[model samples]
Target: MRHLAIDVGTHRFIARLEEEAAPRTCAAFLEMLPFSNQAIHSRWSGEAVWVPLGDFQTGLDYENHTSHPSRGDVLLHPGGLSETEILFAYGSSRFASKVGQLAGNHFLTVVEGADKLMDMGRTVLWKGAQWIRFTDLGER
Candidate 1:
């Protein structure tokens, strides 16, 4: 049994495995979206408001914006998952990256303010299990 913590930021995604005690970097995860150029916006039709892309009924509502087919029982798509799983995994990866970047930036900002403190070191620090390396489909 292993616990995995996925911290998503605006620029990158950080994955930390509780059992391994490591952190991994994933950049360009969001760019792999199938509809990257497609923007979802609120549209005013002749009579009604139209929501672009519509609402997703099934699967986890990732980032509260997109949805994909569920991948069995695993919420986090592990390696060797099904095709749907892979898709969701990549989606999750991208979301993670966005979140990581945002968090990392926030953390950096806070750390910068705490420069006078000696105990607080660098802006980025991973204190957990080992890191499990995984290839991002975005890069593929």
Candidate 2:
């Protein structure tokens, strides 16, 4: 399994890449490691935050798509018909967008710092969009 880190403020979360489950998505995502973006709290998906990936050409691998994602699961929605974004589940979560509740491509699963998931969510939720960075832990 591949590894990555999600860093927000003082919190650091290690994530396991779902290469076997979502190979294509994992490959594309790993290629863009050390990605920094805003972790915005979703108004639609309860207790979830999303990182918009903008128009990346990552092909769809919906094998891991799910509307309801477990807390601490990191997901990517390879936007085709809609915009692409990364979902981070804090509490109960359902990956959704303006269109409606849609499945998100499961890519990263928090392996460490699981307890900090809720705190990260609450930070982004109450304080507004937070700058979160994804780093390839493999380099370290």
Candidate 3:
């Protein structure tokens, strides 16, 4: 398990990458650590937040993807039909793109402070886009 820190506005969350389950995805994501982007409240995906993963693509590597994601499943969707993005599901969520129902590689999932998911969702929803940072915990 590779630990990561997700800081959104004032609220912070901790998650773990399922390296064993998604080796390629995890490795790619880890290499891009300490990236900050806009975390916006997803409209189509119920109770979720998302951020673009920059110009990175995994090209279907470790694409153990899924459309139905449980609460707190961090997914990495490689840009194919859509742009590469990270899905941070707080509650019931359906991973999708503008095209339609799409699956993503389940890379990370919240481990610590899971109880704060509801609050995190509420903050992003009401407060609009917030600064979000994804990084390896040990780095800083």
- Which candidate wins on lDDT? 2
Estimate every model's Cα lDDT from 0 to 1.
0.19, 0.84, 0.82
Cα lDDT tens digits for candidate 2, 1-140 = 67898897668999988888888888888878779988889889998888877787677757678889999888888887568888889889877778888888888889899998888888888889888899887732
At residue 95, candidate 2 shows an lDDT of 74
How far residue 93's Cα lies from its native spot in candidate 3, in Å, is 0.5
Q: Between candidates 2 and 3, which one is better according to TM-score?
A: 2
Q: Tell me how far the alpha carbon of residue 73 in candidate 3 is from the true structure, in angstroms, after superposition.
A: 0.9
Give the alpha carbon lDDT tens digit for every residue of 1-140 in model 1.
22222221111233222122111111112222222221111111111111122232223212212222111101222212121121212211221221121111100011111222111111112221212223222211
Question: Which pairs of residues collide in candidate 2?
Answer: none
Judged by whole-model lDDT over C-alpha atoms, candidate 2 comes out at 0.84
> For each candidate, how many residue pairs have backbone atoms clashing (under 3 Å)?
22, 0, 0
| Candidate scoring better on lDDT of 1 and 2 | 2
Give the top-scoring candidate (TM-score).
2
Weakest lDDT window of 10 consecutive positions for candidate 1: 102-111
What is the C-alpha local distance difference test score of candidate 3? 0.82
Candidate ranking (TM-score, best to worst): 2, 3, 1
Pairs clashing in candidate 3? Answer: none
lDDT of 3 by residue, 1-140 (tens): 45899888888888887877888888887777778899999878888998866667566553678888888788988877777888889899998767898788998888887898888889999989989898788522
- Which sequence of candidate numbers ranks them by lDDT, best first? 2, 3, 1
